[model samples]
Target: MFKKLLSSIGIGSATVDTKLTKAQYVQGETVEGVVDIRGGNVEQHIDEIYLALVTTYIREIDDKKFEEKAVLARYKVSDSLTIGPNETKTIPFQFALPYDVPVTVGTSRVWLQTGLDIKMALDPQDRDYLAIEPHPLVEAFLEAVRQLGFRLRHVQCEQAPRYWQRRLPFVQEFEFKPVSGPFKGRLDELEAIFFVSEHGVEVILEIDRKARGFAGLLSEALDMDETLVRFTYGPSDVASLPQRLANAIGRHS
Candidate 1:
């Protein structure tokens, strides 16, 4: 009775740890991993095992910064099972990564979280930080942007607008302020949003042009939308991407 009581209170309950085949994965690749669990002082019945991919982002409200977590993907990896005292068990799992999972850029991050569900005892969890890399098309596009003399300033994921057809609820923004370019003094900043697929990459760029004179305040008063430029790229365009992107922004800015 004492041992069961102690175990229920998590004094000697089961614990869990997750191991992955690798620490980094491409956004669309499959993630292969195993959850290793060990039973405690008393025999216990575990209801299930859960796994999720999570990331943190900053939200500013009233001059205060609040950190919030975005759960990108999740799954139930295992069913009910029983373990004897001091026994160990392992559950293996494999799942396809979400298409729009945010790649780790600057301070933004992504990771795997594993947890065991049991009735009275506290749930044991394990967290493993993982890196998500951009697709080749996205990598080349960002490189081309940098080549056009834009300084990468900040990156964030914001709520998707009504018309944004995204698998996830949020969209990532890669903000760049021009340092030395024809558009340097003419714009406020340039933000790049990506929708990646197996065949091609779609980009939506928000051109925040510098507000001027009375037009600036009038624009604000009228709730005018920022200029958005949309385009797509594939393997064939790598050679001309830099010039193509520069001209597009120039024309719209």
Candidate 2:
């Protein structure tokens, strides 16, 4: 009776802990880990195990700030199980992170949420923050953008609207503003949105340029009509990337 009461209140319930091979991983790579479950003060029947990739971001509407969670991926680890008291069970798992997953760059973050569902008790869970880095080509492209005098301003992952055609439910935006060269005063900001995959990368650059002429007058007054440019690249383009980036951003004819 005491064991049942304690289990009902979660004192003698099953506990879950997830262990990953490393703290850092590259986008689109596989993460190998194990979900370890240990029986508490009494033996318990385990129903299911769930693991989720999660991240949080801030959104502003009017004068209010809302913190929201984006579930990148979720999966089941086990079906049914019975454990003896003081026994430890390990379930191995491998998750392939989506290529477009928001990396732990600047203020952005990604992590895993693990849950153990007890048959007649509250579910116990765990969370582990992961360090996700951009792929090699993506990193090179970002470096090229930096060499072009665009200083990174902000980076955040937000819920992607339908038009973006994102693989995951959300998308990350890396915003930059010019600090030197021809685009300095003429451009307001340049935002980079990446659509990454195992094969290559697609970049969408949203150029917020200062308007010019009479049309500039109307644009400045209306606050609309930014420019969008898209490009696809592979590892071979790394060497001449800066020049290509400069040309794409209209730095030269």
Candidate 3:
């Protein structure tokens, strides 16, 4: 089940419209958009008008799986007010995306949604969709990985859950393949998790080691040990990727 809450007074409901200014953005970039609301046929006393920034996540609990739960970024776009019949209002919003905003490759399933709740007699809902594109720097980084002979296996968007942090509602994980040379023989699989924030991006990498008893998926290895590494990146530039990845590998070694 998805998470939601709504409360509307006894009058009429209001309609909501949301528009995003750009289809493409970077990890550390800002998103510009607007929310427009129109009154319905009857006058309504609205307790509050607000917009929420939400991302979908996949979660497993007690061996059960769920998808596309809403995450709240902010509230309070407007206070309590009464809108007369057939009235229209507009609100502008600027959202600062975290530096670790996950990169989407191909036609992945992800959404940036604006949800509005109108307090008429009870709360009614309105929603709008926006197109999200990879930032230039993020695309460059992926290109670099491709240059390094890595293939993207799968990519997904998920929420952090209550265990990690109060504010970190969403996270993205990318699985990749290293099919040649030294890495193929020693590593079974590589997974990258991105944690984006205001200041910079935190990259958590987990490489599954080839199990000794059984030859691992990517390569065959005997007496091997698994290793984990963390890397930090910012500015969303192409030039920084090689150096940063190299530095992280070196530190792990």
Candidate 4:
């Protein structure tokens, strides 16, 4: 009776730890791992074991900005089980990582959260940081941008407009500045948002043209100097990204 009372209050309860097959993964790949549960001083009934892929994003409301955690994807590993005292059980699981998960760049982060649900006792939880890399085609596109002499300046995940938000609540934005290319003197900066999936990559470019004389300055004041361009490319189009991207920017610059 005493043990049961203590367990209910979480003094001596089952614990859960998750082990991933690898520490780094590219977006859209399957993540395989095992949930290891060790029983405590008394038997306990676990209602469910689950895993969540989580990341943080900046959200603004009424001119106030705050950071919030977002769950990208979740999966249930087991339904129900009884763990005996001092017994250990390992449950293996595999789930596809969402392509929209933020890559680990700048202040952006991705982590896997594991939890075990109990009826009365506190839930056992574990967290593991995941290094998420850009997809291959996305990587190639970024390299192409660099080859065009745009230096990556900053990266962040923030709230997206309703029209831009799809499966995820926020979008990751990458900012670049022209350093030594044809656009160096013609443009001010470039901001890019990438939406990646199994089919292809959709890129949104906000080209900020440098303000010039009276008319250009007036347009800047009205926030009209920026042009929004969106395009989609797939694996087959990787080789032509440099020329295509140059044309896309040159048209607006």
Number of the top candidate by TM-score? 4
Pull out the clashing pairs in model 4: none
Best model per lDDT: 4
Off by over 4 Å in 4: none
Evaluation by TM-score, superior candidate among 2 and 3: 2
Ranking by TM-score: 4, 2, 1, 3
The runs of at least 3 residues in candidate 3 whose Cα sits more than 4 Å from the true structure, single-residue gaps closed, are: 1-12, 100-117, 134-140, 158-166, 180-182, 211-225, 234-240, 243-253
For model 1, the superposed segments whose C-alpha errors exceed 4 Å read 58-66, 211-225
Per residue, candidate 4 scores C-alpha lDDT tens digits across 57-115 of 99999999999999988899999999999999999999998889888999999999999
TM-scores of all candidate predictions against the true structure: 0.88, 0.90, 0.72, 0.98
Model 4: how far residue 199 lies from native, Å? 1.3
Instruction: Give the range of the ten consecutive residues with the poorest summed lDDT in model 3.
Output: 1-10
Judged by whole-model lDDT over C-alpha atoms, candidate 4 comes out at 0.93
Which run of 10 residues does model 4 get worst, by summed lDDT? 7-16
Q: What CA RMSD would you report for each candidate?
A: 2.7, 2.4, 6.1, 0.9
Say which prediction, candidate 1 or candidate 3, comes out ahead on lDDT: 1
**Candidate 1 global TM-score:** 0.88
Go through the candidates in order and give the clash count of each: 0, 0, 9, 0
Candidate number with the higher TM-score (1 or 2): 2
Candidate 2 clash pair list? none
Better of 2 and 4 by lDDT: 4
